[model samples]
Target: MSPVKPTLKTIAEISGLAVPTVSRALNDAPDIGARTKILVRKIADELGYVPNRAGVRLRTGRTNVISLVLSTEHDMMNHTARLISAIAGEMQGTSFHMNITPYFPSDDPMKPIRYIVETRSADAVIMNQILPEDPRVAYLRERNFPFVTHGRTRWADSHPYFDFDNTAFGRIGVEKLVMRGRRNIVMISPPRNQNYAQNMIDGGTGAARAAGCSMRVMQGTTSDNRNEDIQLGVARHLAEFPETDGIVCSATAVAMAAVATLESLQHRLGEDVDVIAKEAVPFLTLFRPQMLTVHEDVARAGQFLAQAAIQAVRHPEKPPLQGLDVPTG
Candidate 1:
């Protein structure tokens, strides 16, 4: 013998409500009173009720799922992990749940988006690593699909997004180095194809020009490269540009690689050369207290993206939400 599976009728019977009212409460219907909804949901949880996806879709034509398409190439050191946790936390106790879909850098970014839209697998999508004129954005827009991006594309004005202000980060980082009397500055940016890369380059170059300092973007490798490759690349760049006294890194891993390379060359950190980097968490100081850093708050971005995604699915007729977090010293 086995225990009976909990259903809507089971919850309704326990809560002293009709089946329809219980269903509406569980679905977070706006007409349902908050107190009644809480009571119904409490009973449902006590019964360990799980909604059948097929039945729910048949009735509402919605899967009540938000798909998060993330890149496997992202920094695994607390960056992507924090984002995923925050998004999941935000979706807790909500009508919707999150479904993560990961893709490698070598794979086409559109594959997951296309599959989700074509199959009606998810009600909305959330993604990052945006290009200036991303095809995924265009495709989703054309189909009138409800989606939100963690980073903005060229057509950002028309979509919902929550992005860190990388341009401001670049400028601020350069200004910090310049204030320390460093004239020859170089930045290790992301790939040129990324939209934020251009923003960072523009800000750094513009700030250097204003300060009358020589600034250049490192060649041959991006912040996404492996640690060993980045260390070797930094060493080569230092050999070519010996005057490089200040280094700005786009990622924490890049900063670590740069520091390792400098250390091998008998350069004292914060004395021989200053290194500034951006991080999602505040552990960089624990690793190297001498390093300079700016916080990017990936956790906040995740929460905002999740909220915007839910809003888009529930109320597409309303205005899209947009947020930009500027760098803080």
Candidate 2:
């Protein structure tokens, strides 16, 4: 291996090709011939040609790096990986890259923002798993960096974003349960501070008003509850199942917890009580309660947000974007 890290310029020089052409070939663009790509790869390997993030950003006006910020842990859900992959796949021909940056959800989450600013590691950022009053969103907006959010932030009315219409999802779930002869319904929602959670509550209330059903929205705690934390809420409500009748879970965690709790309660899956929840991706199995899901198709959402950020970064004069809502069943 070469002592120095390789760069696009180094590969270009060694392979006797232009920098852009080398970039295109190394990135696996179909436009480049097999011979040139192979030659570039061989030379890149020989020279340890690692692309310098700073140089690339300076040259192309982009770091070729897209950052996906999460409010919770890095491995919060399966959607994280799926979303990143979707954006990366969509950026196949473009000089863009995508990765996730995990930050603790806090009253002041300036750490992630500071990292992005101080290091300048990202060309554009796609903030995900956000709360209603997200400081990161405010920071990015003030800084004038191109960014898109997977979830809507309450601070901004118009911005590039891709989100599910939670109100519709909540309404549909409640309506469906009421149609199935359910009278009392309970909803497990995100904390009240989340905009989507509020929307879900509104939708559920509307359905309840029309159907004459009782709906209560339970807020989540912020004390580091991974998927396991879902169980505590389920355990609290599981004993009151017959009185509850139907359930509307605001997240996959609630759905998962309900499933486990119901199983423990010896309640028949689809027969005793109907369960519906919001999901960012399709489950590997369509079994039981998971089968009845309000799918957000987060991968598609990621693709949409990625395109929006790329466009906004490239063309600032473009009209401000409204949140694109994915229709759910």
Candidate 3:
């Protein structure tokens, strides 16, 4: 004989709760109390009751799945496991599941994006580090693929995105340095193709003008995404301004090279220079204890991208371009 399959009624009866109450708890409805929710879920788990997500989606016209895409090879290089884990953990009780797809230039990035739209890889989509002339965005929007961005775009109002105030971050970073009595500041930014880099430069420039200091904004190599480009940029800054006292780097990868460059120039970490850095990964084991830390939590950004994409898919009319600032400590 086949095993008995559990349903909402069966779980509700076993848990000694009303079917409606059981449904709310199982579906993660906000009205349910903590203990009731816990008990009902425990009972459902014990009875092996799996909610029919497909059935729910069918009725609601939603797939409850999201697609997250990384635009650059550097993101692939620093594919943090913590980001995946964090996103999975964030979806513990949500009705949706997430799908992550990676597309590279060499792999014909456009091909995968096309497949995503046609094959229904997900109901909604999320992208990071978008190019100024991004065809993927235009293609998806033209076809009405509901999506969100981890970073903002120039055409942001017509689309939905959740991004940080990176411009403000740059201003704050540089301003902090200026207030501390450093005049010449070098900001290590990503290539111009990336919106974050341009925004950071604008912010730094504004802050520099306000502080009456000289700010030199330099670019990282777009090709290969190597540390050498960052190294060379830092080397230029070091040689150009031996009296440079403060630095702000967009990527932590640059900081690793910056540390090397600083040592080569015989500059002390705290006394000779001060730095404010952003990173997708957390700095857990820095030998230097005094570095001011700003954790970007790219992994956390991945999860947000996942959620926003699903929302856009569900309600195309209310596609949100939140531009959220994932707070850093």
Candidate 1 residue runs with Cα over 4 Å from true position: none
lDDT of 2 at 271: 74
Could you tell which candidate, 1 or 2, scores higher by lDDT? 1
Q: Local error of candidate 2 at 50, Å? A: 5.5
Across residues 1-329, which tens digit of lDDT does each residue of candidate 1 receive? 99999999998888889999999999888899999989988888888899999999999999999999988888888688899999999988777999999998899999999999999999999998889999999999999999998888989999999999989988998999999999999999999998899999998998999999998999998988999999999999999999899999999899999999999999899998999999988878898999999999998998999989999998899899999998866
lDDT of each: 0.92, 0.73, 0.71
What residue runs in model 3 are displaced by over 4 Å at the alpha carbon? 1-41, 47-62, 75-83, 219-224, 240-243, 280-285, 295-306, 319-321, 326-329
Residue pairs with clashing backbones, model 1: none
The sequence of per-residue lDDT tens digits that candidate 3 reaches over residues 232-285 is 777786776787888887766666677777877788876788777766665612
**Candidate maximizing TM-score:** 1
Per-prediction TM-score, please? 0.97, 0.80, 0.78
- List model 2 lDDT by residue over 146-222, tens digit each: 78877788755756778888889889889888888878888887666667778888999999999888887654532
Model 3 worst lDDT run, 10 consecutive residues: 71-80
**What's model 1's lDDT at 224?**
85
